[model samples]
Target: MSRDERGRGTLEAHRFYIGGAWVDPIGTERVTVRNPADGSVIGTAAMGNAEDADRAVAAARAAFDGWSRTGVEERLALLRRMRAAFDEAAPAIAAHLVREVGLTTMVAEGQSAMCRSHFDGIFDLLPSYPFSASDGGMVELAKEPVGVVVAITSWNAPVSQMLCKAVPAIAAGCTVVVKPSEQAPLCGMLLAQAMDKAGIPPGVFNLLNGRGGDCGRRLAEHPDVDMVSMTGSVPGGGAMAAAAAPTIKRVHQELGGKSANVILPDADMAEAVRKSVFGCMMNAGQTCAAPTRLIVPEDRFQEIAALAVAAAEALVVGPPDAPGVTYGPLSNQAQFDRVNAMLERAIAEGLPLLTGGPGRPEHLSTGFYARPTVFGPVPVESFLAQEEVFGPVLSIQTYTDEEDAIRIANATPFGLAAYVQSADPAAARRVAGRLRAGYVTINFPPWTAAAPFGGYRRSGNGKQYGVWGFEEFLETKAIVRA
Candidate 1:
């Protein structure tokens, strides 16, 4: 019943924005959205079914020819307008994230700003993008849109993930049908409003809200969908890949990760441990590339463990609106339950709990809040060290030597990201070079918008951001002429 700055009273989740207009969903089933901060009903959205997916796919397919033929200036103009609209709506978007996704205002603001940054980054790259090239006059190479794209984004980063997929696809002259995560569909709706305000052509950009099993599966299997781009769980990506296989459509996934942060023997133990702890606790440890596994020297295990425990205890966990709260609740009851179950399993297996464990903070009685937890002297092969908890949980493991550190860092099926800390910059870079991950940080590099990001191995394939991201939606065709 709350009203936004624009006087809109809660998002009408019962509607889906397709072909530049808000339309009612064919399905009568609705999903009641709840605020994890206090478990209050924030809103409700129509749970789209397979038929809605079909209609969206059909709209995108129909728009492909015209959108793909749009001149660069025209596309750039549209993107500029979209970015401006997004900036104007930033406060509302951030509010939605804070309410629906349990993000603190500070974190939510940064995430909301990232939506504009995605468009701005692409805006800077578009003019210089080599869409067509000539090779010695005999052969010409043309980069063209891949056609209708279905973008499936994750709940942890709904706004950024959606923009990351949709902006690049649109910039590459492809029509897109975006399916935002059901857990945080409101952010997607706000972004769609921005797009509508930007005057994007009908059918060029579409939005649908629904569960992955029904709408997502249908979109992946649809013959009209030229490519499937997803940022979600590994099982979800695998399902999309399998469903898209029958039609042999291109599939790009940014899936899960159990990333490692290695603190070399030469590093400042206290500083390294503190930074790693804070990094793991960011976003309530819901980030896919979070350094959840801390690989430290065996001799310094006690010192590292103590520092980690102190760091975890220092984090202020409370509701999103609480004064000076550094972290908030898990986005939903399911995640809260999952984190508690993992903690229980760890305790049962006799893993040492360094700081917090197995419950909500003592102050809060009813919410999805989980204590910032730390575990130490954990074996590299232990469940605590090998899995993506996606909570404010940290697992500290010991390594005998530098070689051992690298091996332990690469031990998991995931290779999304890795971190190396050392007083010697050269040493840190050396270890970074050996990591199998797509992205690595040596003592933490400055965040850059143009840095290509994705993963290696089971972490998922393809790259995003800057030129690489823009190219993901494009196909190369070579023409020979004499």
Candidate 2:
């Protein structure tokens, strides 16, 4: 394990950050974090229970009054300091993610950078934000913080997810309690360290590490928490909503998706196919909004399938530190097993595996790695096309026409994101408008942190990113003039 200049390991495993101090969990049970690349134990984190959740929520509630009343300038200053602290800690955060989450160094660094970008984005938008507005008549409209926020983030992209929730909540003048996934809590811990270094006020920000059942449930059920923003499975979000229903707290969820990449016949087939394959294989296909379903024209199915197979086969998967490795293993053993089970089920159903299926790559004898697989002629109703495998697996389905493509794309319960590729920008934009997802990419546009991101339907509700995300934590009020 790599150590910092102070001779301390980057992954601080024993304490949870609450009320601006590192404290022990009430429960003694622990979760062992393993390096997925080689199945080696990295460290053990103290599993928090209901008591821990309560303590964290109490801290946030205590801090909310003062924090929420702070002026916009004050909040912007603190965010600036946070961005600086995050920059200083980026290297350590990247290293820790590589060890604990099994992400390649490149991907890990990008994720770390996104944390700082979110801070920058919010800070830039806060100046011009309309916190208070005047009605032309006898009333004025004002936006206020929604009180203490509970941010429950998933394992994949922990840094980005946590910040996407926490930063915006803080920007909206709300105190936050972050519950990071136990599968990869090290990055969250590192973020806490950055917050500490930035001298953020006590109780304004806290971190709790534990399973979803213990820490997550308690936080969701806690009356002190006014909002629960989460990024995870659909069922997990449902449970959180149910837990918070009695209190009627606001619940914003960015849940699972089986997003589709629709390629028009007029588009450059080779380029579209290559990018689509990369989108599915990126981050080992663990991204919540990954384009896992590739919808193509009936006549072009075989051609696209061949291109996808070649693209998937060319990817180099190995240890995070290995030379030329494009990606790493699944984040944990559970995900590894789940991906394998899905592959086995697809094979059992006689789906033709174009390149990979049912096992680790030949070069890898052990570890939680799965082969980068692509299967073609997948029916829209097939399990492979509907459920999220959350691994490096891609399923290709054919569409008779544009209408059929839209139908197949919207067939799944998920509506997180969609992709459209066409020779004409106007046509792609029109198709993008027709998609049911909350976000759509036309011809692989460069990712902009300023764009609003979220989902529709079963993928979950609420937006996160730039101004839209900032507004999610604010409650509106109207004052009538006498």
Candidate 3:
């Protein structure tokens, strides 16, 4: 379809950005970006082959020598400019994310908030890094840049993940090669433009538009790339780390999650159920850190389950750009189908559907839409409860008491994030400490940018954002005097 015919301008398919310029994809084929709202083609974007990934990697290697050696002050100044550029372009970026990814404006705003916050937080922590240190009359240690970095980000919160890796890597004086998810690559291209406007040197921050299997694989496996950081599926993260292993490059991954919300018996059932549904169902539950499983008191099962169902029923799922929209369409068809299958399996397994079950909303039949699903008394071993659905599905399981709640919350193999809602702050803190996860939101506290974010166990390793994030791009060397 032509741009004029569609009324939104012709979307170009197959354009890759390398060394500050947009070029045609090296591959012959292209991928289409579909609006989940109606399953209509929004535009076509580039899908780079393995060969194209190599070319991007070569360009990144060539630029890294100069960019990595540049002084910290120079890099910081450039990032400051980039931050300003982002501020000026905030509205456009936010709008693009909403239209392309089918996220509510509030969620888009959250992505913007994360992007701006990461940019500002990393800069704040840069001055504190131990770039050079001394102990007595001898040199103690020095943290040096690790050269070229390949950062692969997921589509759920495109800008948020990109900034999580890119901002800190830049702050540590490392040149970056970003491979954004094909599902939402336009945002990456726009970010490249912002970097250029910020006066960043060519090749300093290169963006490649391509699929994960081909372009992303090559980038992860390239020998010239010195380090890799990715945020996506656990399998994807493992593959990237394995690809980087032969070259001995540092691999930092933040992957899949099925976080638990442990609602203590002492906690208010109304408040706990409210936050659990909203948190898990936010972004259509596409977030890696979303608390999808709720572990509540078994005795209070009926009470909390009813409240959760009410919350889900109250949610207004519609087009992202629509007024008063609470939830948006799933990112793609695959996610939509997966959610439906899981719901069906839950029903078949005898789990009672507290609120929404499956299928598209009756009103909007075209786009990927799954009713907000909530299940109570679900078996912990069920795929719907164990696996990461990455959809607007919440599984409610009841527990005996605080001890049982923590046990259920800690049952998941993925430990990315956890949540606890309690009337008593001390009790919440005590529970938070015991949960084996990277982050815990007590009473849904404001997500802080300066806080360190990563995962434990199968969730993947290495921190992102703040000082810990910046350090991932640096290699610490110790010197001892005779």
All models: lDDT?
0.89, 0.88, 0.83
lDDT of 2 by residue, 1-482 (tens): 34573323535467888998988889788777778888777677788899989999999999999999999899988888888988887887788788888888889878877887898898789989988999788899999999999999999899889988988899999999999987886667778888889889999989988888878999999988999999999989999999999999999999999999999889999999898888888888899888899999999888888899988998989997677887899889899999999999999998888989978999999888989999989988899999989999999999998899999999999999999989998889888999999999998888888789999998999999888899999999999998
Per-residue CA lDDT of candidate 1, range 146-263, in tens?
9999999999889899999999899999999999988887778877887889999989999999889899999999999999999998888998899999999999999989998999
Q: lDDT, candidate 3, residue 62?
A: 77
Each candidate's TM vs. the true structure? 0.98, 0.97, 0.96
TM-score of 1: 0.98
RMSD values for the candidates in order, in angstroms, are 1.4, 1.6, 2.2
Q: Give the TM-score of candidate 2.
A: 0.97
Q: Per-residue alpha-carbon lDDT of model 3 for 350-388, expressed as tens digits?
A: 888777888887777678877898887877777777899
Poorly placed runs, candidate 3 (over 4 Å): 1-8
Clashing pairs in 1: none
lDDT against true structure, model 2: 0.88
